[model samples]
Target: MQYRHLTAYALLSLSIGLSACSTAPLNLPAPHATETQSLLHLEDQFHLNNLATHFPDPLAITPEMKAFVKQHVPESLPEVGRLRYLTEALRNPRTFGISYHSGLTLTAAETFEQKHGNCISLTVLFIALAKEAKLNAWVNEVVENQDQELLADNRIAVYKHINAVVQLPNKQVVVDFSDLGDAYLRPQQRIPETRAAAQYYSNRGVDMLGENQLGLAYQYFKRALQLDTGTSYIWGNLGTLLNRMELYTEAEIAFREAYSLDNNDHTALGNLERLYLNSGKKSEAKQIRQVIVRRQLNNPYWHYGIAKQAFEEGKTEDALRSALRAIRLDNSEYRFYYFAAQIYRELGDRDNYHKFGIKAAMMRKAAQDAE
Candidate 1:
């Protein structure tokens, strides 16, 4: 799953654990459980900090942007004008364009000021702007293609998917930041405002976790879970957070909860496998490895995950090889192209990077045309 930058709200990625396949996993039952002592303290002090701090209001609209929306969307608007003003214009560099930056979760004001953000950031901006225009719009976390990658902190972030849904007087509009030609955000489920806010915190938590800010990340993840306990991915991510803390027991419980919520969620299962192996349960680890292998066959995302891992390890050739394999398996996934381009760029192959970049741009156009 991958979110496309430059697209308003492209549905993005998710990754289950992959350590289950390690021929020899690391030692487990972590010594001192990392920071478990501080964790208990956080359990108490964390509650003292209100959820509002973590899930702060992301819809802070600026007066200038509000006025811009007002000027563009009149009470009586032409169909073409409505479409242009609401979608194209906001992203057109020559106009009131917003830049697309991946791996971020920005509030509306942040997006506006920076003019850049990931899919969720763009979606939140869209929702805020649409509301300012007196339009009915909301955020939706639709079923999506998940893309997983290793972060700077050696943690993994399965980029979640989000989009903005606007109900016009006579038509409904879906604004997505994606390049693939998928018509639906898979499940197309409507997410309430509160749940969307919770996601903001969860994504930020992922970022913080990658930065090794365990306490801060824990607070964000906890708030996210409290706001929307049903999101299996959040539970899975929470498990990852706990694992990094070396809190194996707590991590296991979180992963199990995630697995029970979404049996097919390989990420949770993967984390569980890691936990078992880390704790010296080789037999259990082997069992999980078998399951992961069975579930990965014919799954293009598996190849994509390998590509990401290789890239992280500075294996450009391997990354490109795996990326090409992923494309061969599923050319419809635009994200593979993005990775391919990045790989080429890393190798100083400017021509190849441009070639793949253009291909990705063309696919994005294809998606927009289909839309």
Candidate 2:
């Protein structure tokens, strides 16, 4: 999960939790429920007697899942053939043919039975099946280093994609069930199975919170923090829930914990700012707003959005300036180059237009070929 400016809207991450498993067997580490710090007073406040104890394991392989793999991936086939057949069967319309939806975060078994789920559910299912086939599989957080759309409720949904990766002796295959292709974020972060399971719980908490199931949401968030105490987004999510429950003191702590874990992800900071404002701490809120502005100024995607808007408004010079700034900040995205080419074309600078256009086309082709 990633964070963005919070004043404009609440920021939430829709991360799919795909945990890692070794080739020998799927012996994922158990959650360190005792060491968690984010959910300090919430257990007593919400009367969470069992807390993280009773929730079903999101990655538990059901009989149906095992049966599907056994029938489609024959033991007679070589390792490579088995892997190929498994992937094909998962994607084949005549087989599992899992589809995408942004609803509940389901377990691997539930995803298989339902045949539809969001990215998180799909990736979870993939890792579970890969484990059943005795393959090295894990979850990776693919950061696009980009901003996402704002929902109707004025929430900023900055999505960090989750995908399953299967490793072989000489090669690694990323089964990007999200279908993001090669145009994914760079510098992937591998999640431990325990933390990945925490992501599942956190995602489910988000879903429950959406449906106004506050008590259940609290339970899910508690389980998530217990599993992985380190994730800032989960902390931030719990903070959001706490704030909703009017547990302001604990909410403050959770938000602070989140910010301390990852200052780069500004969700905590944004929430903090809101909390300050609500408590009549205008000076603190002002200071946080300044910090947010400074961070936004440094973001290349923010500048790119500005450039696009300027171009649409026919402010050619202004668009060019912002586009160039965006390129200077990050030269990896092809869309920036393509936009620069358009600006140059509008300015009648034929040589530079062709230069940027060619560069954009080459970059785009390279990305596709890499896939």
Highest-scoring model, lDDT:
2
Given candidate 2, what's the lDDT at residue 126?
81
**Model 1: residues with Cα > 4 Å off, grouped in runs:** 1-42, 45-54, 78-80, 147-155, 169-171, 179-187, 304-371
Q: What is model 1's C-alpha RMSD? A: 7.4
- lDDT (CA) per prediction: 0.68, 0.71
| Every model's TM-score | 0.69, 0.79
Summed backbone clashes in each candidate are 18, 1
Per residue, candidate 1 scores C-alpha lDDT tens digits across 40-77 of: 23454334455445356777789977876776676477
Model 2 misplacement above 4 A: 1-38, 47-53, 146-154, 183-185, 305-324, 338-357, 366-371
lDDT digits (tens) for residues 24-137 of candidate 2: 321112223332354654566777666454698878898889998899988787667777888889878898776776664788888888987777788888889988987888
